[model samples]
Target chain A: MNVILSLIVSSVAVFGLVVIAFVGVWGAHLEWLFGVVIPYLAVITFFVGMIYRVVQWGKCAMPFRIPSTCGQQKTLPWLKRTYVDKLDNPVGTVAVVGRMILEVLCFRSLFRNTRLEFGNGQEIKYKSAKWLWFGSIVFHYTFLIVLLRHLRFFTEPMPFFVPIIEKVDGFFQLYVPTLYQSGLLLGAAATFLLLRRVIDGKMRYISLPADYFPLFLILGLATTGVLMRYVLKADVVSIKELTMGLVSFRPVVPEGISVLFYIHIFLVSVFFAYFPFSKLTHMAGVFLSPTRNVSNNSRIVRHINPWNYPVKVHTYAAYEDEFREKMIDAGLPVEKGAPEPAKPE
Target chain B: MYDGGKIIAGIIIGLALLTFPIWYTSGRAAPKPEVKLPVKEKECVQPGPYMKKKHMQVLDLWRDSVVRVQQRSYVAFNGKEYDMSLQNTCMSADCHAKKSEFCDRCHNYTGVVPYCWDCHIPPKEKPEEKH
Candidate 1:
């Protein structure tokens, strides 16, 4: 039921975006609005929303030294130290950094993820979940390359490196236009991830519409991009001119650029605007996560809670000053006063 | 514990920063450079509308053709051949005599900093006296 609802909602959102874009560009003929104004607005929303979210995350106070460690901690000197296994500060901070690097770039933690397989009462089995890790890594790297490939349109003099990247990305030369490996890989990864969530009972139970939305949206974006590139030969020249116009701050609604271009641009704009508010912010939030970013050095150094404050401290000096006679009569040690016999006693 | 005011202020500031360019250029249109006709030849390689929209692209093609492809002549849409050199094509007596009013006007409005001027000198301040 959840999956159905999620699918329905995601489908509607993607369809709504397409319909709006088609109408805005084709029906209304607001080329400037679609091409220039919305693009600019989306860009502003992306940057501002991203910065605001990040700053909000930054300001959050983590009162605990909570580094999610999976292996043995720094213990007796004789005990073997598992450097990467959440142990012994991982041979100083470099090991921690290496761990983080591995975690971020390679999804090492997810690579090591294990799920409980069907088991008898006597024995339980933990199975490796490599598919998730593989899908994620492939998806991320491909997305990066695809983004880099787009710089050709945004820059002038065609920055020497961008062409080189384009050449490297299109090295497969599989088709007339030279198929990009990333484009193919992105599709495969997105499909795998979506199917994983849909088909797996456990994953489906946990999945929300927010999770499915980006997947379907990206699939739409990638599909349109691929169609434009390989199937529909849009006007590359005027497209570049229009893009250059935007980048150079002299926007012109160039003639002959296809509506497909507008749709692609519109979807991309939606992605940009939606990114900060959605789970997509894990790209930045991952770096700010205390469980991931903080060091596990509680034994070596005290982790004080910056938010912790003393409401009222009762010092011995104050107590002694206030109850000096009482303390002395009660046989409690006094700093400066002599004890006197109590009349009642 | 939420500081509503602080959060709102941060968001407001962030929004202001991001939308600065849009608001800055609000109510302003792209600066249209003044087009002047040359005394020698009135016709360019392409029509006026085409040139207005795509002169940069045409110039880029010319730059690559002459500099890299070793092609020195340009065949226009009208089937007339002209020098591929920008120095000859763009700055000659038959073309606009001054780059300041003609070229700089559009470039300045668009704010596109061209690299052509880095290597190529401008047309001499005043056309040399015909010998």
Candidate 2:
């Protein structure tokens, strides 16, 4: 039922985006909304939703030492403890942060992952599982670079670095039309990642439609974009004009922009708006996850919950005083007056 | 041990069966023909000033060609033909020279980023204009 619901929601969302983009591009009357208003709404939703989710996550209470660890805990002085794995102090916390950066940026954990199996005659064996790591790294890095490169679209004074990045990305000079490296890499990486989830039994068993939907939607966007560049070849001037109008809030639906461009833009807008509400929120959630971000220093300092309620206190001494004769008869130590004095009372 | 071995083999085969579709579907499912370069016209017929009566006509022709090519080469959503002639033009060396002037001006004015400049060669610099 969960899978069915997920599939239905994702399909409707993606199909709706396609329709919106089609209308924006082909319908002469609808261009203003698609070209300008929808994009603004998407951007606003993306920012506002991200902030709200992050704040909500911040409000969560983690009252125990629940930092996920893979190494020895800090205890005896002579024993060596892995700082990054078992965050014991400030220095250890910093080391953990560094490790996380590598994991997030380079997908280090995925690289280190291995698949275990039993081979001929039931001998246990381990094989390197690197493809998932490779694909994830490529996808993330390429996505980041593409986003950074797009900074040119929103800014008036073109940054000096934009041209430099453009040159670097197209340095390979693959064809009559210079190819942007990120675009190709993004497609390849997304493809590999999707394939891994679909083909690997374990991954496939756990996969939801949420996983497949993003993959399909992104692939569609990338395919259309590549086509625009090397195949159908849309009018660039009108495209820029349209994009600029959208950015400046006085959108003038340019006449010559292709429907494909509009579809691509609309899909992108959907992705931005959906980003904060979906599993994609992991992009922001990672920073607040207590398991990842908190330090393991429970021994060093007391962390009392500020919201804890006052409670009645009981002591073993009081109990012993009340049952001194009984405790003595039962061969336990008595903490108060003996049985003779209690009888007089 | 034999049971373990069987389980391992089953898992491997299962994984292979699962991954095949994703790999197969990576590229375009139905491949289309690659775009062919335009045959160079031998006559150096100069188009008029940017947005001028004659220049607009030539621009319109160029725009029409782009629209026609896009329509022929790609499929649009909603099954409607997209006329590329209505889209903006570029005046920079990046896009074709005759139609780009109008595009460059507004893009420059609004500070819009053009992806074409990233993927295509800039037009060759024209010689200095006579006073």
Candidate 3:
């Protein structure tokens, strides 16, 4: 089955990365390759590949001004329209902007996800399904917070808001080192997403290696990070020294940092390199999606297709003139007596 | 490009945020913090590497056992027994005196605001060193 295939491939890939990084750094002592060379290469690939993908998207010819409308259109003075309708069936540019903001920030469209249920007597039912949206929102926000928390290691002065965010994130004060909920939530939400793909038959049928790969990769990254922070503690100062050295372009491999830290960064580097080429590009592609970005006002405003070209045609008058002689010889009606016998030419 | 202006602006903003640390530091060296280790007492309750990584956890365990279970003696892995008081054992005059010099160095460097000082009285600051 596709599910088993994708699961095996992605699991092996992530596990293989852990082995390579652990062996390379811990056993072989090739710290420079794993720490410096690969991270820089991955970051460069991320930025350049992201820009290239955006440019390629921009160059695409969108001939149709089509916006997927899901609510009542703004028409007929007597007809009543609610505020939600304006956003769902946006007409003007401002309304389109509002719709896009909702779509991008809140994932409003995905919040409207529906599942179909088949009955025994050839009947069907549609039910609201919000679990995917919930899992997705939690995963994305927690991932963002975790990334922001990591800025402390990368920066020298440790930007002003980093500690504030860290304090709030560890507000519960659950464990010895002040457990951060974001890391736990990230792992939980990613697990939910992966399970949904595997358990739901219809979802599993449609899911590809691309979908499972990122989920598996993220789960691996989160597990290693959590292990490093809690179960087997790594020297935070030495890790920071290495990270700060990396960002400042002055590389240093600090002594006594655990190999788990290397595995975490290795997965991170792999994620950076894999982002642009995979479905993860939706982070940028969402802004360029024509269906969500365009205003649905095809009747009110003309949409001249950019790909439309002027087509040449032969007029009926010219065609008739060219065949006038044959038509007269066959005793058919002629326009001007066979064009005056071609002026004796 | 179709929407060249907006797309370029978005990319520029993204890059600025992504490369914030790189540009903010501007290749300037941030020297590592240097702590003044106590020369009189060299041996700690545990070894150096263990203390470097899990000192906070060890402290937490000590706090829990001292308060909840009324256990005051901590037996280190190396069969060394020490009193389980932060003030008498860890911060005495012979070991890690002057919290500002010993504790604050790495804490300030890593920006970790441990609340150990919130309850316990801080050790006295050391006098200025002679030139």
Q: In candidate 3, what are the lDDT values of residues A1-345, reduced to their tens digit?
A: 478898898888889999999999989988888888999999999999999999899888877777888889988988878888888888888998998898888888889999888877899999899999999999999999999998888887889999999899989888878899999999999999999999999889998888888998999999999999898999888888888888989999888888898899999999999989999999888888898898888888887888889988788788788888888889988667655445655
Choose 1 or 3, whichever is better by DockQ: 3
- Give model 2's DockQ, 2 decimals: 0.04
lDDT (Cα, tens digit) per residue for candidate 2, span A265-324: 888877788888888988766655566556667787788875678988778877787787
lDDT by residue for model 1 (A1-345), tens: 588999899979998998898898889987888888998888878887888787777577777778877767777878766555553245356766676687778877688888888788768899997988989999999998888677656654444566677667777645545578889999999999999999999899999999999999999999989987767656555676676667667788877767889998999999999988899988766655566656787888886787989779899888888999888789988887755668794
- Candidate order by lDDT, decreasing, is 3, 1, 2
lDDT for model 1, please.
Answer: 0.75
Q: Which is better, 2 or 3, measured by TM-score? A: 3
Candidate 1 scores an iRMS of: 8.7
Which candidate number would show the highest TM-score if scored against the true structure?
3
Clashing pairs in 3: none
TM-score of each: 0.70, 0.66, 0.91
**Stretches > 4 Å off in candidate 2:** A1-16, A81-91, A120-122, A305-307, A316-334, A337-345, B1-131
lDDT of 2: 0.62
**Which is the leading candidate under lDDT?**
3
Candidate 1 similarity to native, TM-score: 0.70
Cα lDDT for residue A38, candidate 1 = 91
RMSDs, each prediction?
Answer: 9.4, 14.3, 3.4
